[model samples]
Target: MFSGLFLLAGLALLLINYVVVNETVPDGTGIVSEVVSGEAGAPPPEMYDQVVPAPRDSGQFTTKVARTAVETFRTSTMRQLLIASGIALVGAAAIAALLGWLTARRALRPVHTITATARRLGAESLDRRINLDGPQDELKELADTFDGMLDRLAAAFEGQRRFVANASHELRTPLAVQRTLIEVAMADPTASPELLRLGQHLLHTNERSERLIEGLLVLARSDQGLVSQGPVRLDEVVASVLRSTGGMAAEQGVTVVSRLEPRLVFGDQVLLERLVTNLVHNALHHNEPGGSVVVEVGDQPALTVTNTGAVVPADVVPGLFEPFRRLDRSRRAGRDGAGLGLSIVRSVTRAHRGVVSAEPNLGGGLRITVHLPGLHRALSPASAPAETLGV
Candidate 1:
């Protein structure tokens, strides 16, 4: 396209030069003198002949001489014009290309910003906005529309979170009442064998209901976002959880092993403890009679728990963190779990701004890892008091 423009410019210059050469430079100088010879009061023909040379060889020689001079002038002028035009064309093309590149980059700046903003926006970060500033062009309008959509999404998620929290809190009262009634019925001295069995089953059902409610409450709370941002010693949290669950692990005949390092993180101490407890409990609950559970604490503020259990398919590992997701239907039928342990683990981890992943062991087990943001300073029992370290 540039080449075509350059060619057209050169041709136009040549055509203009042709017209100027013909109009400005006389075609035959001898003819002009003869035409004025017969004019009134004009000099006599002989007088004019003396001043201007007589027409020679039917004036063809003079015409040829004039034509040669015109051709020479046109050729030289057109050569200079061609050189100038070529330079101008090259410079114009370069400038246009540069300007075009810059213009395109500038035009797409808002799109890049939009992409970045979208990537950053998530369940926990819906409050962010594009807030673009510029003229009321198409890009600016697009940014405004995006910001509006985000506002709506933030409102919707906020509403859903609130509803879950409120509903969970409301369910706790009735669940407590049911547990109290079931316990009272079980304590009756005159109850028959069949009645006692029924009462025991009711009691068990009530207990499971209570656990489910508690799990739901914890989940809602975690999803509500972190309320406390305090330094939490992960090693201490793990130690405390181990002590609390020692009896349960003993009943299951599962050995609990640990490699605790003094790793400090910033989050709610209770939630962090819950996260560790859920992982440890899950490991213990799902293991074989002689299986062992290994817990590791490292400087990455990371916690890993691995346990020998029934063979778990690799395909099912990803769904373990989802709510009400269980690996085996038999486990659910056996009343082994409420299927909320790993789900709560994930929720609390996210609330603490951490990440959790799970992978199946080679033989028959599961390994779950949680990585949290670590504090810069190294924490040790001697460096700080127990309470200050959230132990």
Candidate 2:
């Protein structure tokens, strides 16, 4: 289409030049005056008026020379105009192309802002808004609308988090009081055996409820992102957890192994420890009678835990990280897990700006890996130890 328009422009310029050359240049220089011509408005010749006479060949020769000169001058002027037209046509096209590119870039600048805001958005980052500033046009309107949506989302999430944290804290006090009362009642001098058994049952239930509440509070906090960070020795955290849980591993006949590497990560130490503890507990709890749990701590991936258990389908593994999820409904996630082990692990890992994944082990088990931003710090050989339990 543009080519046709350019063709028409070129044709128009040529036609205009041709018409101008012919019509405006005076074709024969008005008969090439050889004798003096009478001035216009001078009286018309009377019936007896006398006129000057000239040689006929002389007049013809002057007229021919004038006609040739006019033709030559017309050719030279037309050639110069055509050359100028060609140069103007090419330069105009180049300028138009450059202007078109600049206009397109300016028009799409708002889209880049939208893309960057989208990339940064997350469950914890709902406060971020595009808030693009420009004219009251489509892109500006779109940005305002996006910012409004983020405002609503931030309010909603804040309310939800407050409710969960408050509800969890409020519930803990009652549970603690109930446990104290149950213990005090069972301490009576003549309490029946049945009463003692009932008290024990009630206490167990109360403890489970407390654990669930605690998990909820922690999950809510983690969803809000980290509050503070410091260099934490992740390997030492793992070693300490292994030592404390060694007796449980022996009791369950589940061998525990750990190859801890020296690594330092900047995060909340308490949350990181909770993250490792949950993984270790789940690994030990969800295994077969003779199953084994292997823990590895290192850089890059940060930590990995593999355990033998029932053959978990690949599809079912993802749900295991969700709250109140387990492989089998009848099965429990360790004695105190309350089905929130992996869920808490996931939240804590995310709070530290990391990623987690689970894969069904080929040999009837599950392997979970957590990747956190960290560095490996070299230490003496004896400072890092490989530990094995229940062998």
Computed on alpha carbons, the lDDT of every model, listed in order, comes to: 0.77, 0.79
Q: Candidate 1: TM-score?
A: 0.70
Per-residue C-alpha lDDT of model 1 across residues 209-314, encoded as one tens digit per residue: 8788788878877886776678888888888898788888888888887888788899889888888888988998889987888888886638999899889999
Lowest lDDT block of 10, candidate 2:
43-52
lDDT of 2 by residue, 1-391 (tens): 3445655676687678767765675443452342224332332132012221325456555445555555566677778877787777677766666676688678989989998998898766787889888899999998898899889888988888779768876888899899999999999989999999999999888888888888888888787777667899899899889988988898889999898878888888989998998998888877878889999988768899999987889999889889988678865433746788889999999888899999999988889999999854556455466778875
Error of 2 at 351 (Å): 3.0
The C-alpha stretches of model 1 lying farther than 4 A from their native spots are 1-94, 112-125, 220-228, 332-335, 351-353, 381-391
Give the distance in Å from residue 162's predicted Cα in candidate 2 to where it truly belongs. 2.6
Instruction: Flag clash pairs in model 1.
Output: none
What TM-score would each prediction reach against the true structure? 0.70, 0.71
With candidate 2 superimposed using the best TM-score fit, by how many Å does residue 248's alpha carbon deviate from the native? Answer: 1.7
Model 2 per-residue lDDT at 381: 53
lDDT score of residue 127 within candidate 1: 84
